[model samples]
Target chain A: MGKGILVVLSGPSGAGKGTICKAFLERNKSVRLSISCTTRAPREGEVDGVNYFFTEKEEFEKMIKEDKFLEYANVYGNFYGTPKSYVEETLNSGYDIILEIDTQGALNIKESFSDGVFIFVMPPSLDELKSRIIGRGTETEETLNKRFSSAADEIKLAEKYNYAVLNDTVENAVSKIESIITAEKCKINRIKDHMDVLQEV
Target chain B: MGKGILVVLSGPSGAGKGTICKAFLERNKSVRLSISCTTRAPREGEVDGVNYFFTEKEEFEKMIKEDKFLEYANVYGNFYGTPKSYVEETLNSGYDIILEIDTQGALNIKESFSDGVFIFVMPPSLDELKSRIIGRGTETEETLNKRFSSAADEIKLAEKYNYAVLNDTVENAVSKIESIITAEKCKINRIKDHMDVLQEV
Candidate 1:
């Protein structure tokens, strides 16, 4: 079997990126979603190690100074970062890692790690995207509009992504993601290690 | 849908590239195997367009001089080349093109065209590869060993390929190739065109 692949997923909020990542993990047993460390207060029902590796501001800053995160960003005054240790541990253990990150963070990760597959999820249509944002019921009308406008700007940057998976349906999106992982492993560079062993025989 | 992808496949003679390509095309109606323009006399029962596009040496040379062929080579004193027009026509017609070319031709095509996937097919194991070559019964013992030695050298060049497909089973190999074509269409650079058009509305 070929070594594992690193898949970085990004999309505008309400594009159902979280749901697709959950489905991908359910279908692929060998995949691990890298749990990010955040400086934000954990909401009710969120576990320390399960939902996120909750950290204090000072600790987060320390990690930053140490260059411990692959990429980090501040959201609403709270810092969220991907720890290099967990992702590396998962990959070294023969499991692929999936990082559900934002577009900026995805770009940063891609710059540092050129081999990671950067996928940007897309909504079916702008009207449909607006409807989904409204359906979330977690924001005001103005907030929803702001998100809708942000998606437009972000779509411009999506051209830099390695793949764009449209969330027309959950099932279809998950299928495309699975196919990408499978096809990526078959890439010549990733599987070249096996050939080196084959030559000795 | 985005423009169809062009995949150039190459491998050793007994690596089962033809079998894998045929099975893959059977499952994917969008994929068309590129037929080369050859100066060699057609074998018994080989159709003109199906087996190869037979051409006179003068016409073939004229195409070469006009820089029409993507890549051309002389094999056994007979010239064979992939016509750029046929491939471009097929792609423009919205069909994915698959060329069953050799390593040398595959490299030349890769250098000339930056896009399109380059897949190098290889047997699963050396012993298995030898068995497949021997089963063909077209070569004597001495020639068989020579061909086997050439396969070793060719596998070393697998580094130049975009993907290395192990032809362990026809069904599995075909599925992998089909998956690759499906995955390529989902690439962000390709799918973003449709999204860009949608955003304009």
Candidate 2:
């Protein structure tokens, strides 16, 4: 077996990245989502390792200092990060991993893992994005406007990604991501070992 | 519609490139095979425009002189070439085109069309390749050995391709090619117009 692929999925908040990732995971059993380490407390029904490897703030901070995180950020006085060891081990063990992160985190991860497949999920339009965010009903008009502009700014960064998948529908988006993974596996660089074996034959 | 992709499929003669291309086209109705211009007489059941675009030797030489062919070669006193204009027009019209050619022709096409998706197909094993060639029952023992060595030489060039797919089965090869086409469509560089439209939104 070959070393598995690392797919970094990123986009704006309301671009249906989460939904697409979930649907993709459901369809692709061989791929596993990278479990993030967080300082935030686990909510109801959330398993310790399955949902997140919840840790204390002190440990999370120590991890940051050790450069153990692929990318980390302090959100609402709580820490969230992707543990580099976990992802590396999974990939080395021949298990594809998907990291669904925001634009900033994805870019940060790129610096350390340039080989990862960076995919940017996109909303169909700004109006569609606004409607989706508004559907959450958890933001005031002021906050909504701020998030809208931030999302627009994020969309501009999609150019930095290797592929931009428009989230017109969860099914379509998931299918496209699946295709990306399939194509990546077929890439010449990725199948060097296979080629070598064939050469020997 | 977005511009169509030019997929250049190449491999050794016994690597099942032709079978995979035919299977892929059967499933993918939108993609058309690029018709080659040849000076050879059309065999029984060969259509002028479908199987090949038969032309006079002088006409083919004129096209070669005008640099109208993407790639051309003379074999056994017969000339064959890919028409550059037809490929460009098909892509401009947003219909994907597949070019099934040998390794030399594919590399030649690459010089002029670097944006094309170049895929190198491989048999499961060289022994399998030998058996496949033998199955054809056309070559003598001396010619078989020569062809086998030539195939080995060609396999070495697979590294130059963007993707290398093992033709373990026709279905698997066709599916992988389809995935490649789907993934190529999602490439960031190819979707510049889509990005521009989304930016305005």
**Top-DockQ candidate index:** 2
- Per-residue CA lDDT of model 2 for B1-201, tens digit only, reads 788999999998788897898898899998989988999888666789987899999889889999999899874467889999999999999999999988888998999899999999988888888889998776669867877889888888888999998898999999999889999999998996855436574
lDDT against the true structure, each candidate: 0.82, 0.87
* Location of the lowest summed lDDT over 10 successive residues in candidate 1 chain A: A192-201
lDDT of 2 at A173: 93
DockQ per candidate, 2 decimals: 0.49, 0.61
**Per-prediction share of native contacts kept:** 0.48, 0.51
Candidate 1, DockQ to 2 decimals? 0.49
Q: Which lDDT value does model 1 have at B118? A: 90
Candidate 2 CAPRI grade? medium
Model 2 regions lying over 4 Å from their true place: A40-48, A75-78, A139-143, B40-47, B75-78, B138-145, B195-197
lDDT of 2 by residue, A81-192 (tens): 9998989999999999998888888998898899899999988888888889998776679867878878878888888999999898899999999999999999998997
- Candidate 1 residues B1-201, lDDT tens each? 457678998987788997887788788775788998999888666799986899999999999999999899986478989989888888877788999987878888898877889998978877787889898886778878778788778778888888888887899888788777767888876676666424653
